[model samples]
Target: MENKKIILIVLATLIIGAGLGWLIKPTEDKTNEISENHSLESLDHQEIWTCSMHPQIRQSEPGACPICGMELIPLKKEDLGADPDSYQMSENAMKLANITSEIVGMGNASKELRLNGKIQVDERNAYSQSTHIPGRVESLSINFTGEKVSRGQTLAMVYSPELVTAQEELLQAASIKESQPELFEAAKEKLKNWKIGNTQIDRILANGKAIQRFPIGADVNGIVTEKMVELGDYVERGMPIYEISDLSKVWVLFDLYESELAWVKEGSKISYTVNSLPGETFEGTISFIDPIINSQTRVASARVEVNNKDGRLKPEMFVSGIIKNDNTDNDTQELVIPKSAVLWTGKRSVVYIKETVDGRSSFKLREIVLGPGLGDSYVVEEGLNSGEEIVTNGTFTVDAAVQLSGRPSMMSPREKETQKTNKFISVTLSEKEKQQFEPILSDYLEFKDALVADDFSSAKKLVIILDKRVKMLKTSELKEESAKIWGTFQKELIKSTQSMISSNDLQEMRNNFDELSETTIGMVNSFKLTSKELFVLHCPMANSNKGAFWLSESSDVKNPYYGSAMLTCGEVKSTLK
Candidate 1:
């Protein structure tokens, strides 16, 4: 009876325990099931982490960016839909590079063209003082050049036999006034014919004798610029006695070249300063522009009339002037950009335009057509509009960054320059010059191959040999522009080679290889130096972000810019066959 009672007690305890276990176990199991379902999805891309600001950093797990110290974001977050052709740079990157931007808008358009000029006598204000009656000069009132004279001022005294005779006739006629009244009037008129004023004639009659010497008076107020007569000098009627120039006004004449003719016009304002009088600025208006250009000088005179009552401005004084275009016609708006913002490639003018892409600031390369240059700025005729942002400062830095990222850039070979890559220049070369050039091309290819193989010593040695061969080339046989073109590229090529030779570092050697490669590519474009068809391969990842071009004997790309790190980082951009 005791054994059976114990068994019944144990069974009752077991029943209660089973019911508690069921209730408690379900809560843990349900929680664990939910976790297992999400575990696979969580591990999808969360295992590895990187910084959003710097994509170069990588870690096994989440932390901070080693370079920038920004909080590490999941690698999956970095797939921000960045454009392939645009350059993606974080705000931190821009700040580090000292990059700045500005909004493009139209404002008052103008340019200040600095010019050189000279002060001159106003043609209308210059005069020639002349003697009216023929005579021999007895005395001179104006003795030297630049002597001030006024209208009706006696300039010189001259003795005239004809005037003496006319005076005697007038006196004789006056003696018999009642007998011959017409004769006396005719004698007075004869003296008047010689420009003898009525006042002077009356003075002669008052003296009651024929005056031996007559005085010549100035006709206008001026300074005598040229003395045409000396003491006791003989003079004829209407003979110039002195050259006089009015000092109250002057003219400033500026030489306008053929290229600068359109910028200046009649009535344009000019602010000028004379070399003789420093720290003093003067203003004037353009009174005239020569209608015809001087054939010998290839220039036209732009005249500015200035008041010279103070007599400070002297003739032939050098003057420097500035002309600022007014752009007063506000009806049309012109787009102008800073000269620093433009990347002027021979074929295309480009700028880096800043825009928002994927909720982040991005800079894209854009080609623009440029108009006339406005001193420190350029006019944009096409490819841009108002209200857009552009990289104004550190534009080359941005382009370099974009270029290193494999985007188009100023140095990047495009379809325009590449289309004519196969068009070899028609420059004829002598057989001896061609023979000397062959080994140079061969050595260049070897130098490139050494860089591709990361052989530093071989590269240096081969470049030295290449430099010698380049120096040996003689261009005396070539003529005209062809010679100039060859000289330019050849000199550049030799310089790059010398740089590579002096560099003890492989990276530096590779850096200089960029210049060498471009020159070689240019040479290949202009000449078919080898029997084998040469290939112009471009490595977008070369030159630390600036794309580079290299010549390869084969179609396969062996990038010399990156060496073994990215031997196959490029492709054939163009070919020379």
Candidate 2:
């Protein structure tokens, strides 16, 4: 009975343990499945990191940038849309570069014009002191230049024989006043002609003596600038004895360049300070602006009149001033940007416009028709609107990035259509000539792309291929008329190709590229391309703003002239179909 009971206990225990194990196994499997799903969800949310200094660096995980070795930050999630015109920068990059922008609007704009000037004597206030009587200077009270003299103060005592004769005639005339009234009046007039005061004549008549010495008095109150006479020197009538200038009112003359003329105007307010007078400020108005620009100096003088009654401002003292002009004229109020935002190349002024592309800030380099320059800023005549945002600082930094990306910037003005005269000649070509010319055109394109990338070494290598291809053309296959055209085109091609081969300088290469492009276009027009359509692109900012043209396989403009400075500064003019 005991053995049977033990067996029943064992069977019951086994059955209960099996039930508990089955329930726990399903719960553990469900927990493991949930954890695996969570891991997959986290993987889907992974971020891509990029460097601020180097926009080209992109990575899936956070780390240092390969190019600049800067800490990488998470790149904002957005579609990497292809827009060749715009240079996209991540928010992290903008922050790293300290880039900032403002929504430009039509408003009153002002610029602080810092100019260097010098204090000068007002030419209108300058005076020349002359002697009225021919005499010998007996003694001079004004001994040296810079001596201050008041009006009516005696500058010198002179002995004049003419004055003595006049006095003698006056005395004789006084005695014969009843006999000859006209003679007495003539003698008094003679004395007056010599600047003899009536008081001195009365003293002579009262004392009954002929005066030997005459007093020369100052006509104006001023500091002597030039002493023309010495003690005991012989003087002629109407000869200047001294040059004096009133410094109470001084002029601060500033040099304004021809480009700066638009902002400076007569009656503009000026605040200035002289190096000689530290910690003191003086204010004045621009009294004169020379209308004529100096051809040699390319500058004009802007004069400011300041009161120097306290004598703090000295002549020839160096001064610095700020010219304040309202610059709120109708034309100027259209649009304006800070000078720091503009990159000027000859006549072309360019600014980088910030555009939002797929939630990222992208900069597009745009050429603007500039109006008057208002000191630290420029008036925008064209190419921008009221609400557009532009780079106010770190302009060069953004341009550098554009260059690396092969886009346009300041050094490269955007492209425009070529003139009708610059167009390729419309001449048909024989099959053999077409075959010979097309390869050369292709090589020329390669050379152009090398230059666009600013790879001088690669450009040099491609130029060799261009030279070889040009020489490979055969003149025998064409008829007389076709051969002549071929000869002309070949000569231009060889000349331009040779010019490129001879120079290692990137700038010179770009210069030669202009001629190369023109000749290639002519060749392609004469004998059409068999493979792809060619684009005749022109950059208005190239070749010192005179503009230049180049050929490319794609419609996109890659300016060889500016290279990295303005990588994308051109546009497609027409296609060689």
Candidate 3:
């Protein structure tokens, strides 16, 4: 009985110890589960949120993009695996934007160069009818301009006292012809000096009387453009009496701009039409191109000699012409792209290349070298492959997205230091020219500020002032290189300012500002501003997604393109010293 009690006590103690150990182990497992939950909560707090349109805008928590005011979405870890130089968008977003791309390849490209010109009289075929004898006009046969006259036709009758005296001498000499034969020949020679024909001399000798009045004959068949003599008008020898031109051949002088100088050559063929002659077409070959380009007009004349025997083409008639020129030499093919695919920033030509990002569509902005502009397209010289895909339509949208993401774009670059090194020869201006151009810069800043504030009326008023200031630029003192730059800027400034002033809508004015800023920036860079410290600023949301740049007196960020929606959205791109 004693042994049984000991064994029961030991068994009871063992059972109690085992049950307590089980309860303690459950508490430890619960603690471990709580710690794991805490770690997961910490990871959730570290998530990053960003705007889809503006991926550059990053926040620790959910918020809106600072630049575009777009709602921020959570960034996934898988998105980080995409290319750093490219950007990604959803299929729905791509469809909504209507973005399209095409594969560039080599092909033969030709451009039709349209030119305006006028028909002019062939200078070589023109002549001036003049008299050889000094006389007084007795009667006028050709009364007005545009009267056609034939060769050897008598145009007017003149009375000459000298001729009558000479005839009298001849008559006297004829009386002593047997003894003074030399005298008779001498009198005949004097009449010949006055352009009197042999027949008229014979008639004078036959009649044996002095003829006082002489008839002046036309030298060539032509229509009279000017009559220098009137009835009873005294004229001197060698004086031009009538200005005449033959319409057998005519010259078509076409105005060629500096940009078109390359395509037009001496032997190029051209087909033209005139508004006066409906449903009629004329063809001619270029005979000559003016060696000198006009300073004011910035154009040269291309001459085409055309046979106008039919008289269908008249002088001073306005005409239009088309010149079909091949875009290459040696007939080799080249890569070409539509003009819409390019984003010209004055300093650079950029295109957005399509890329695959995380198994989806994306785009990367790339700089390219352009060869020739073939009307609606351009030939690619460098910076692209033969089979590369490029954005052909809605390129502006892609560029805008690239800018919003703070990547290299038409207006913005990832590394601005690279752009600071300019390859183009710098245009230098004198101190006087720079001083005179300071007011233009001031007026431009004012216009830019108005657009930034989204004040259309103020912007229009300021653009008017800006236009006058740009027009007032003293281009007279500029050197040849500087004058070329000035000419280019003047054309662009007039176009932009006029467009801005005529537009009442804020968006259009902003669009005009983009072009205006491009010209202004180029001017500033080429001339090297001195009076003020100009800062180049950019706004990615302007011009319907195409980014734009503006000049500012200060480095402070003021969103001129976005206005009150996002007041301070841009950064200083460069400081012009």
The candidate scoring highest on TM-score is 3
What's the CA error at residue 149 for candidate 3, in Å? 1.5
Q: Decide which is better by lDDT, 2 or 3.
A: 3
Residues 1-577, candidate 2, lDDT per residue (tens digit)? 9999999999999999999888677676788998999997786577767654344456888986543345787764452333545688889999999988877777566667888878899999999999988889999999998899999999998899988988999999999989999998898889888877788888988988898888889999999989999988999999999999999998889999876676778888888887877888878888899888889978899998878799877888998988776656646556777889888788878888898876789898888898777667677889889999999988889999887654566665445545533444556765666676667877887888899889999999999888887787777877777777777777887898888889969988888777787777766766665457777887765666557778887876567787767666666778776
- The C-alpha TM-scores of every prediction are 0.53, 0.59, 0.60
lDDT of 3 at 475: 73
Off by over 4 Å in 1: 1-84, 89-93, 111-120, 160-191, 198-210, 249-290, 293-325, 356-362, 372-375, 400-407, 416-577
Q: Model 1 — which ten-residue stretch has the worst lDDT?
A: 413-422
- Highest lDDT among the candidates is held by which one? 3
**Reference-based lDDT, residue 151, model 3:** 97
Clash list (residue pairs), candidate 1: 403-545, 404-545, 404-546
Candidate 1 structure lDDT: 0.80
Query: Where does candidate 2 have its weakest 10-residue lDDT segment?
Result: 76-85
